[model samples]
Target: MSGHLDAVLARVDAGLEQSLERLYALLRIKSISTDSAYKAECQRAADWIVGELKGIGFAAEAHATPGHPVVWAKGAAQEGPHVLFYAHYDVQPVDPLNLWRSDPFEPTLATDAHGRKIIVARGASDDKGQMMTFIEACRAWQAVTGSLPVTVSLMLEGEEESGGKNLPPFMEAHKTELGAADIALVCDTDMWNRQTPSITTMLRGMVGEEIEITCADKDLHSGMFGNAARNPNQLLAEIIASLRAPDGRVTLPGFYDDVAEVSPEIKAQWQGLGFDEAAYMAQAGLSIPAGEADRSVLEMLWARPTCEINGMIGGYTGDGFKTVIPAKASAKISFRLVSGMVPEKIRDAFRKHVEAMIPADCSVRFTSHGGAPAITVPSDGTYLQQALRGLSDEWGTPAVITGSGGSIPVAGDFKRILGLDTLLIGFAQIDDAIHSPNEKYDLDSYHRGIRSWVRILAALAV
Candidate 1:
C-alpha cells in the first residue's frame, strides 16, 4: 500500500504545475452566482468542470436548477468504499475593487510578506482552489492506476455563496444516488494553521429569529408624551439586555439543559494546541474574553453555544436626530447552537423569554428565518483514522481534530437527510481572506493539498 501510494504521490508531484494550470483556468471564470449578470458565466464554469471531469474518465454533466446549474460526475465503480465529494464553483463578488491589488478575475501567483507563494483571486481559497485539489488528486490517481482507488462522485454547487435553496430539493430528489456513498468529503474548511493540518469533527448549527416589539400605533413626540407614552425602543433594549446575565451566560430557560459539557480528553487536546488567546484578542483589538465564565476563548468559540444580535433597527436617525418615539422596534437575533441542542427548542425558549418580558400594553411578534441542529462526527471511525494517518504522513505532523464555530449547513444536511457522515478537510490557511478583497490560496497549500488527497484516497481504498 505504501509503495503504491508513493508512486501515486510522485505522479502528483510530477504533475503539480499542470494541476495548478487547471486551477488557474477555473479561477479565471467570473462565476458570481449572486448577480444575474454573471449567470452565463456560472454556467460556463459548470460546463468547464463537466468537460474536465469527463476528460478524467468520470461520467459527468451539468443539471440546471431554478438558479445556477449543478455539476455531478461519477467515476467507474471500484473495489473500495464509494465517496461523495462536495464543493462550490461560484465565487463571491469582488466589490471595493480599489482595495484589490490586481484584477480579482485574473489569477496571479505572488509572494506574501512572509515569502509564501500564493494564488490571488476571488474564490481562490473559499472553494475553487480547494476543490481543484481533489480533482487534481483524482487526475493523478487515474494517471497512475488507470482508475481511482474507490468509486467516487462529485457534486459541485453554484449557489453556495448565495443561499443554496435548490440544493436541498435537488438532494431530496436524488437522495439514493448521493446517499449510496459510505461518506462525504467536503473541502471547504481551513487548516489549523500554516504547518498543522486539521480535520473539522464538529460544526455549530444556527437559529435565526427576528423579533418586532410594538408599542404605540404611531410615532409619538417625546415633548408631547415623554413620560406617559411607552417606548418600544426602550422595551427592546431591555429585552435584548436580559438575554444574558451579568456572568455572560444565556438567561433563556433550558438553554443550557441539553448543552453537553466538553469531555476531559477533548478539552485537554484543545488546550495542548497552544492557542494564543491574548494574540487572538489583539487581532480583534480587544484585551478581554467576554463569554461564559471559566471557559477559554477557544472553548467559548467552538464548544459553547452563543446568542448574538445580528442586527437591530427600530427608531429613526438619519443626518440628524429625530425626537419622535418610534411605534415599534425590531431586532434580528441569531443563536450559534452546539451539539445536543435542538434548534426548535432553542427558538421556543427564546420566544418564551421575550414574551415574558413584554409589558401589558406592548405586543411582541417573532419571525423565524430557519434553524438547524448541530452535527458531530465520531472520531474513532475507521475512515477518520485512515484520513488522519494519511494527513500525518503528508504533512509530517499529527492531524488535529477541531470544532468549527461557523456552520456549514450541508454537513448537517448530509447526516440528517442522507444518513452519511462528512469529512471536512482542506488546505486553506487562516489568512486566506476568503470573501474579502485580495483573497488568496497559498501555492504550498495547493501543492500539498493534492498530495494529501492522494494519500487519503489510497488509505481509504484499503
Candidate 2:
C-alpha cells in the first residue's frame, strides 16, 4: 500500500557500496557452464543466488537440472501484475587470458580511457552485473517499504552461455509456477548507447546445423586424381558459394516465403535513431556494407533474415603442402530468423537445396544442432509504455524501444513454452566486450541501472 519512490531511490544511492560487494562476491566465482571442470563452480553460483534471495525475504531455493542448477525464487504476493524476472548466473569461458590486464575472476574498479570508472570482470556486463541490478533494486524497495511493489518471481539460469538446451524442458516441467506470471523481464541485453536507456522488443531467433559431404571412400593423392576423382571439397565449396547470390539474397527455396515486412512506422523510428553506419562497421574492421543490398545496417540486423556459414573444414597443411584431396568435407551453418519465419521449415528448405546440389555418386549427411523462433513484443502495449516512462524518468532522457540482432534463446523459450511476453530491459552497453577478454561494466551503468529498475517497479504497481 505504500509507494516509497523517493526513499527507495535514496536507499539505492546509500547502499551502492554494499551492492558492489555482493556483486563482487558473485563475480569472484568461476561459474563457466560450458566446461566440464567448472560444474561445481556453477552450482556454487546458483546456491549463492538462492542464499541472497532468501536473505532478502524471498522463498528461494535452487533446483537441480540435467545440466546446471536453476535458482527459483518468489517474493511476497502483491496486487499488481505477477512478473517473472529471468537472468543467467553462469558466464562465458574466459579464453585468451593473455589479452586481459588483470585476473578475469578478480573484480577491479578502474577508470577507462574516457575517464569513466568501470567494474572489470568476466561476467561484469553480460548477465551477472545486469541481473544484480534487479536484485539490488528489490533489496532497496524491501528496505524502504518492507515489501516489493508488485508480485515478483525470478528464474535464474546457469547454462545460458552454453547453448542453454536444458532450459526449455525445465520450463515445461515448472510451467504452472513459472507461467503464472503476467509478463517476463530479461536483463541480459544492451542499451542503445551510453546516454540512452532502452527496452528491447525484438529478438532474432536461430537455427544451427552442420552438413557433411562425401565423394570418395578415402583421401586420394591430388596428383593421381587431379583429373579423374570427384572432389568433395570442391563440391562443398560450390554449394557454399551458391547459398548467397551476388545481390546478397539467400538461394534457399522458400527462405523468404514466410518473411514479413516491417511496418513503415517502425522503419521511420529506426531511421530517426541517427545510427552511425560508419562507426558500426569500423568496430568490426569492415568498411563495406554486406548482407541485403537495399537495407540499412539496422534493418539488416533487426528485421532481415540471414544465412551465414560459420565454419568450413576440408583439408589440412600442418607444416608443408599435403596435396591430397580429402574424401569428406563439412560445414557449420546458422540462420538468424526474424518474426514470421519458422525454424523447421527453413532447416528443411536448406536441406532440400543442399540435396539438390549434391551429385548422384556422392552422399551427404545432415546434423541438426538446435532451433528456436524469433520474439517480437507489441509496439503499442500499455506495459511497454509504462516501462518506457519509468526509464525516461530515471535517466532524465527519453527512453527508446530497440531490437537486437543476437538471439537470447531464453527469451524465445519464455514465449514458446510459458506463453508470456517479455520486456528485454537491460542496462549493459554495446562495447562492454562481453564474451571476450577484459570485459567490463561501467559504474554509471550499474548505479543508474538500479535506479532505473526502482522507478520501473514503482510505475508498474497498480
Candidate 3:
C-alpha cells in the first residue's frame, strides 16, 4: 500500500504543472455567480467541470438551479467508505478592480519576496483552487491504480458566495441520493501556517437580524421639535448600546441559556497551538481584546457566542450638518453562535428584548436574514484518524485540530440532510486574501495539497 501510494504521490509531483494548467483553465472563466451578466460564465464553468469529470470516467452532470447550475459527479463503486466531496466553483465579485495588481479573471504566477511562487486570480486559494486539489488527487489515483480507493462523489456548488439560496432545496430534493455517503470532505478553509497543517473540528453558527424603528410620521426639524420630538436615532442608539454589558457580555434575555463553556481538554489543545494575540489584534488594527474580558482570544473567537452590530443607519449627514430628527432608524445585527445554542430561540429572545425596550409611541419591525446552529464534529473517529495519519505523513508534522470562528453552512447541511460527518482539510494559508483583491494561492500549497489528498485516500482504503 505504501509503495502504491508513493507512486501515486510521485505522479502528482511530476504532473504538478499539468494539474495547475487545468486549474488555471477553470479559473480563467468569469464565473462570478452573484452578477447576472456572468450567469453564462457560471454555466460554462459547470460545463467544463462536467467534461473533465467525464474524461476521468466519472458519471457527471451539470444540473440547473434557480440561481446557478450545480456540478455533480461520482466515481465507480469501490469496496470502501463512500465519501462526498463538497466545494464551490463560484468566485466572489471583483469590485475596486483598480486595486488588483492584475486582471482577476486571468490567472498569473509571481514570486513573493519570500521566494514562494503564488498563483494570483479571483478564485485562487478559494474553492476553485482548493477543489482542484481533490480532483487532481483522484485523477492521479485513477492514472496509477485505474480506480479510486473509495466510492467518491463531488458536489460543486455554484452559489456559495451569494448566500447559497438554492443549495438547501437542492440538497433536500436530492437527499436520498446524497445521503448514501458515509462521510464528507470540505476544502474551503485555511491551514495553521505554511509549515503546519490543521483540520477544522468546530465551526461557529450565525444568526442575522435587521430592525427598523419608526417614531413619527415624517422627518422632523430639530429646531421645531428640539425637545418635543422623539428621535428614532437616539432610541436606536440606546437599544444598541444596551445590548452589551460593561463586561462585554450580551444582555439579551436568555441569550446565555444554552451557551456552554469550552472544555478543558480543548482549551489545552488550543493553548498549545501558539496563537499570538498581539499579531491577531494587529491584523485588525486593534490593541485590546473586545469580547468577554476573562476569556482567551481563542476561546472568545471559537467557543463563545458574540453579538455584533454590522451596520446602522438613521440620521442624515451626507456632506454638511442637517439637524433633522429622522423618523426612522435601522440597524443590522449578527450573532455568532456556538455549540448548544439554538438559532430560533436566540432570534426570538432578541426580538422580545427589542420589543420590550421600544416606547409605546415608537413602532419597531424586525427582518430575519439567516440563522444556523453551530457544528462540532467529534475529534476522534475512524475517518478523522485516517485523515490525521495521512496529513501527518504528507506534511511531516502533526495535524492540529482547530476551531473556526466563522460558519460553513454546508457542513451543517450535510449533517442534517445526509447524516455524514465532514473532514475539512485544505492547503491554503490564512493570508490568502480570499474575497479580497489580489487573492492568491501558494504554488507549493497547490502541489502539496494534491499529494496530501492522495495520502488520505490511500489511508481511507485501509
What TM-score does candidate 1 reach?
A: 0.98
lDDT per residue (tens digit) for residues 1-462 in model 2: 335799999999999999999999999999999999999999999999999999998999899989999899999899989889999999999999999999999999999999999999999998899999999999999988999999999999999999787888989999999999999999988888888899999989899999999998999999989879889889999999999999899889889998889999999889878899999999899999999898888999999999999999997647888999899999999999999899999999999999999999999999998998999999998788889999999888899989889898888888898999999998888789999999999999999999999999888884
| TM, every model | 0.98, 0.97, 0.98
Residue 80 C-alpha lDDT in model 2: 88
Query: What C-alpha lDDT do the candidate models reach, one value each?
Result: 0.93, 0.92, 0.92
Ranking by lDDT: 1, 2, 3
lDDT per residue (tens digit) for residues 1-462 in model 1: 445788889998888888888998999999999999999999999999999999999999899899999999999998879999999999899998999999999999999999989999998999999999999999988888789988999999999999888988888889999999999999999999888999998899999999999999999999998889999999999999999999899999999999999899999999989999999999999999998888899999888999999999988868889899899999999999999999999999999999998999889999999998888888889898899998999999999999999999999889988999999999999899999999999999999999999999988988
Q: What is the lDDT of residue 30 in candidate 1?
A: 98
Off by over 4 Å in 3: 1-3
Error of 1 at 261 (Å): 1.3
Cα deviation of 6, candidate 2, in Å:
1.0
TM-score of 3: 0.98
What are the clash counts of all predictions, listed in order?
A: 0, 0, 0
For candidate 1, the per-residue lDDT at 81 reads 93
